[model samples]
Target chain A: MLTTPIPDAAETRSNATFDAILWALSRPGLPRNLPEPGEAALIEALLDRECAAYAGDPLLIPVLAQSGARLVDLSEADHVFFGRLLDAEYLRACRVGSDLYPDDGATLVIRARIGQGATVRLTGPGVNGVVELQLDGLPAGFWQERARLIRYPMGFDLLFLDGDRLIGLPRSTKVEVL
Target chain B: MTLASLTKPWAPMSYGFLDASAKRELRRKMVKAVCVPGCQMPYASREVPMARGWGTGGLQVSLTLINPQTCVKVIDQGADDSVNAASIRRFLSRVSGAPVTLDTLQADLIQSRHRIPEEILREDQVLVLQVPNPEPLRSVQPNMSIARQMHGDADYGRMWLQLYEQIVRSGRVMQGASYPSMVNGRHVMTPSPIPRWDVPKLHMAKHLTILSAGREKRIFAVPPYCRVEPLVFDDVPYRVEDHAGLTCSRSGAKGFFMNEVPQDDGTSAFELSDSEYGVKSIRRAEGDPVDLGDTWYTNGELTK
Candidate 1:
């Protein structure tokens, strides 16, 4: 994990969320273009930051070498799934949807080699028809799994990358792999 | 400005899509808002791959107005504790690195939903309200050409008549949130979803007001000293709404705009007031950023 003084709290805040959304819609399967190269430091910082709309407190950060946030009190909560996803859940079953709140399920963040390849046919609001992006050897059930969450704006918010290229597909999108 | 060179940081944001150019684009819209004095210009809005029901428009406004020097306050359902309010507060704090607070008074800009703050705002303050649907004639008629004509000529006789019809048909206005208004006697527009209760506050507000919608992809504004009046008949004037005796548990204020928070047993609680920078001002020692509270937030209500 990298370390530096939290800049001045004032420096990091910006209004680019809409811009990001526009980028996702316009580009279709292409990853939202980063105006600059994605630095390892920036992603790490975002992971540590938990949006207030989500349930958490001054959520603590754990730097067990896999640096990110963790819910402190999850005994009565769904700690197992989050722990499995982030901390140590094995990459066994390509679990697409959870049992409870199946409609509003979790997004699987795979830190793997994903590509805007030709295996998948993607079309939805942002695309002018079918746009294509490919990933080799992901959790086998990834796309079939996401199909479980495709009702509307009630599913996972996906962020994928191979090494440099990154993309986000919110539930409003339709992902069809041909 | 090749990426290989130009190492000065903060020049380009590494995460999310909005570049400084994007923020600059929004700044252009804001200038028109200032120059025309209460015109709701429709601008192209980008969807930030979030829930459509979310506050994308407010997010855009805050992004444009915020800078290294600005402090921000965000509220949802008229309370700082509301879920969406907290999320946006943390969001803006992340993007701007400008310190954010639950205290309404300390902010240079305040982003709100459902209600304006119980505290007053100043001329310098910019209040960005999130709008879901902007077209006042959306339900009245679907013709874009017709709606544009209606706004261009300020020919709201049809809108006025619809309310009149409501009074004639049912003894009430027949509409609730997403109420319509006339901006500076020109733009007949919808003032987002801030219950009819908060509509009057926009009239001649000292600070500039901006509105945005991410789902509908629109942005609008009300300039300082601009007029924002609701539809009403001469004999039956528009009346202010009261929240069945609503009050803020923290501030002890009553009948401000409020929201219902679902309690554990499926009952609900009332939140009638936006956060007050008043308490935070007292909490912090007289020196730090908290001192910014002394000037605004208590610019107090715009009472006749």
Candidate 2:
């Protein structure tokens, strides 16, 4: 399903509820395109490694290959989350198939190690100003991988994280790459 | 619509506050259910403000999918008076102000417990089973890794052997509720204590069948038009409880799902603990067991 970037999900249901919501609500005048929070949980999800997918993010090659996580490049992955905002902790593998047999192929859970706002601010989609988040010690193809997953209106989304906060930029969110 | 009109009665109405993440999560799993046939989606269960066993999972789904346009029915043990069912129905009716149905014929979304209703469900209706435990593997084996691998590889030969062994020891298959089955030759799931009779209904069912276990914290589905077969062998097939001549006392119905009843006698007499309604019907007509055409149960007396 294609979108216009103003996702209502992450705005209300970010994992780390306290800081993420506080930060998003904190900026009344700023564009509300900030990342969600809680990296620890996202990381735990990935470590579970029940599924792994390249929803459209090619830059995931370095991170995925390094982690020995297989690639399930489902072009039709419904709920896409692409951005440097991955928590890598709370993230568990995404369910790819039916419920009876939960996707054991490798579920993809998102975690944020670093985010965009440390040096840059990401604002678009549901943003009022700038969403704060960043990632550090990323793979060589981080930006390229992040860009690769962007198939506007059809690709997944991203939750770029910086310490405790992150921005949710779905594929249709129209990132300026600024 | 003015603010007064919007808050006129109850319900969040159209454009519910489910946002999108929760919907996406639910929808993602839902779509996968349609795609892969009958697999359980281990979703990121969102904690509803409601406590456990409160149908939060079902409420969340209803909030996400149903708006002003939907009519919902929530039943427990085929009755609307059940507090859990009523609470859930009230939540949806108040939040979405959708109509509630006590009759099986009037529901658009039927959230059920224990029974599938004697009435046939229509295609327009979406049946959601309130599951306390989604995994059939939980009963036989506790390890999830093994269960996951078992489901992935369809290693349910053991489940069948376990039941068959019970039949050997006793005269019948000793399974009561949460009978396990293979949905589309994959994904071993609990057909949710809806009776072995309901088990057959799941096979090639017309409407979408979604099972949510909030306390167990997992959601699974069986898509429409998929084949769900109870595991059996060429020699021994799926056996429904043929309690010979059992019936419910109040309803005068036999060969139905009967709940246990403790008799209030001065001296404790351990007899068949079926509901009183079950006994009346079975006693009236003297209903006989439906032998598996080929006599699957041959060891004991048929009427005992």
Candidate 3:
């Protein structure tokens, strides 16, 4: 006979956080609820010593430091946390990885208001059909910048955070302003 | 920062059988795999309680994804009661306190070896397949570096040539399993070693599939609503095993994949490959309450 192990608080939290992230990514443009509010739960679930992180927001520096991730510039980082964008320069500077190894592309985490701003239509893999979404609080021409910088099989993935809600837009997704 | 902030309390074991860092790394790779939709992603194949080749890759992914609330189902060669399936299910339950089920409809996470369940997987569900080999170009190109270059270039002429040679040699395609497929019209991937009959179930499927090879240290994914087309010439169409119209000897279930059992009389008896489906059929025939979800195939034919 064997006894079942009970999950601790940290384990439960990370699990929930990952579930939220996975669900959000699997169904792009759909807002999924995170385990707890803000990016702390995400950092706890995803970051570790093996990661090279870059935080555009100074407030996230301590949290990234606590995860034992080596903080570096946007080009060298595998994960980039840009709290809020007033310019689209970060998208241009982000690593798109190479054609040989597309997995090396950086995962960009940005803060934006969901269901509030410019209406965009998303279509590609992981989407059942065309999904319409409204996202605000980014610099002008952000979508164009992203579209211009990303190349198929060699582009970064984006996760938009708004309080406890988040949405994922992979580079393969075609974003059209409608 | 103090050292105490970086460290946490010690425990006998990690939450889901894997440590936090391993899970994190898997999570990162999974994200990339899903984004690319069938492109192989490299990862550190961490040690688990099981052997490297015996569904350990699938086990690791299941462990990283499992939670107390997740209802897991494990199957080996389409049967849930096999030794491999039973052991992996028990181990998963013992480690994470997640409920184990033999029913495909009730399972939230399905870890399978060599076979996909007969029932249709919903969008909310995930299927993790154990991959013996992740590279589809291995047969054509022996050198891995050149193979990687081929994949990067989307040059699948050699794959077509291999199929062509098989057709020229044999009357039909000799590939019984691990058929090469084009996913999302971008990358060619081997959807594990599933039989030709099961490969059609992955085309524009609603569920997400993650195929990992532990020994090979590679992982790939097929996201929901992605196209997975098996390569075949226009003149020679891809064909599945002729198992349709054959009824299960015991359960009377017809038009599903079957396992041929040899008898002493030199005759073969057929049994339903999906054991749970057979059990459900038996129960339904015995006037017991049972729910059978929609399957991928209908009367031995794929609807889509």
Query: What's the C-alpha lDDT at position B291 in model 2?
Result: 17
Worst 10 residues of 3 chain B by lDDT: B4-13
Candidate 3, which segments miss by more than 4 Å at Cα?
Answer: none
| Residues A33-75, model 2: lDDT tens digits | 2333344323322322333445334554444443333555443
lDDT, candidate 2, B1-304, per-residue tens: 2456323233332234354445545554543344344456667667765787766666665665554446787877655667877888877766554677665556777777665654456655678787777778776779977877777677777788788788799966777677888775656788777766567777756566777766666776765555677766667667665543554455454444444555677532222222222233355456544211111112211220
lDDT per residue (tens digit) for residues A82-114 in model 1: 211332223222222222122223333334445
Model 2 residue B10 distance off true place after TM-score fit, in angstroms: 17
Candidate with maximal lDDT? 3
Q: What is candidate 1's lDDT per residue for B1-304, written digit by digit as tens?
A: 2554423355334222354445545644443333233335456566553576689888877866565556888888666777888888777777556677666656778898867765557755778898877788877778866776666556677888788889899998877876788764556778888877677777766665778876776677765555688877778767655564665454444455555667899977765455554344334544455543222122223254
Best DockQ among the predictions, by candidate number: 3
Task: Report the number of the highest-TM-score candidate.
Answer: 3
The lDDT, on a scale of 0 to 1, for candidate 1 is 0.54
Q: Second chain of candidate 3: TM-score?
A: 0.99
1 or 3, greater by TM-score: 3
| TM-score per candidate, chains pooled | 0.55, 0.54, 0.98
